[model samples]
Target: MAVRPDPIPAAQAAGTSLEEELAAVAASSLDQLRPRFRALFRVPVPDCLSRDMVARLIVHRLQEQRLGKLDRSLAEQVDRLGRGQESRRRFKAGTVLVREHDGVMHEVMVVPDGFLWNGGTFASLSIIAKRITGTSWNGPRFFGLRPVLKKHAPEAAVVVDDADA
Candidate 1:
């Protein structure tokens, strides 16, 4: 976790490199190494980062945030709940839902049960699955794994309309 900040010219101007240190960081999963990484890098997170490598970093951080480290099932459920809320907020209706190259028209409805029911009759639940978990599986596999949603969910639901009010 010790980030030798670009070592002094005398220390390594010849050989030792940041990538080598990153290799050590990579030895432990991101969750196990992020604190060290953060401290060493002195970078504020929650900002745009490059792909895959950053994804691993994020996944690791997420793993660390879960209360029960050994409880994989509970951790997954928590992740789903958190991602669901993020997705709802990020893709609230009128917000474009873009996937790679395709576009899915948005028609979202926040039901009384805290379920975000895709509004259009032909809406694909897969969108919810992919958006929430980065995977697209059939059926309620996504819903079943999600945390038990409450009746009045989305404590910070940003309503784009006033009709409900």
Candidate 2:
């Protein structure tokens, strides 16, 4: 079998800044992008992909290499959304979500384990919502993470007199 060429050039391997590499990718032509795409993705460039798309994929890979990939849970959530599946709202650790109910403002902080509310660490938002509302409620909906579905009204029946008919 023939040997595959290195995806990253020597200049890039030798500590090139992300901006410089991205600029180079942006300036490269289709022919130039093919090998880079193959190297980065470990597969031949698809015939359907445009030069801009290839460049973007390469840029994303490069960024992932330098910065790091998305968190596993976040990536799964994104995939679920992409597949048109329902997914729970995800918040980064230390993010504060706020909602107002009964003229009182309530704040919840996202923690690594779960959520922080009212000086207690809870596993789910629904519990906090229940504490605040005194009734069982979907935590995400109560906190505005999920949309509240509206009930549809029934169609009105028509009444016609025999003479009119």
Candidate 3:
């Protein structure tokens, strides 16, 4: 008979710091992680998942337990962003966006007021994209921040002859 490892609650009884627990999880091997994963998740670790993935999931769960999970609205927003359902993309200050257009490389830095490009501050990415391409362009799409939308071709009309009917 094989011995079962202690669950996360029992493991936490050791009173280790969150960072220490996280580090331990990061250093643990696949075999070591399986029982911990089972204990924390209350389910068998899927065989299809790699060791790295299992470790990440375990870490996330630990963090959630230690420092509460995201609120419902914030979690929903994150899920929407991940699924590309959110239209507006927010960039933190100091973020740098780069794009290549017509053999020229353009770099834009996100600022508190707006965006900085070529020593000038602009209100939006569209303005920067227009300046670069000499045409109106969706800034996020131009800079590859957003996915390209494909235009569907119109369906052909089918005609039926009364004689055939």
Q: Which ten contiguous residues of candidate 1 have the minimum total lDDT? A: 95-104
Write candidate 1's Cα lDDT for 1-165 as tens digits: 875444212212366455544454445543444455465346743445543475466445434543225577666667878876432232234322222213333333434333354433325545665664465554232333234355642122123542322
lDDT of 2 by residue, 1-165 (tens): 975533445235776888888888888887778888887888999999998898899999989988999999999999999999899745677777777777777878878889888899999989998998899987877776665675642122121222211
Per-residue CA lDDT of candidate 3, range 1-165, in tens? Answer: 996653333356676888888888878888888889988999999999998999999999989999999998889888988997964667777777767666776778888899899999999989998998888987877777765775642122122222211
lDDT of 2 at 48: 96
Worst-scoring 10-residue span by lDDT in model 3? 153-162
Superposed Cα deviation of residue 48, candidate 1 (Å): 43
Clashes of 3: 0
TM-score of 2: 0.56
**In model 3, where do residues sit more than 4 Å from their true spots?**
1-10, 87-165
Highest TM-score: give the candidate number. Answer: 2
Deviation in Å, model 1, residue 106 alpha carbon: 2.4
What is the Å distance of residue 34 in model 1 from its true position?
Answer: 48
Better of 2 and 3 by TM-score: 2
**Stronger candidate by lDDT (1 vs 3):** 3
By how many angstroms RMSD does model 3 differ from the true structure? 15.6
lDDT of 3 at 40: 90
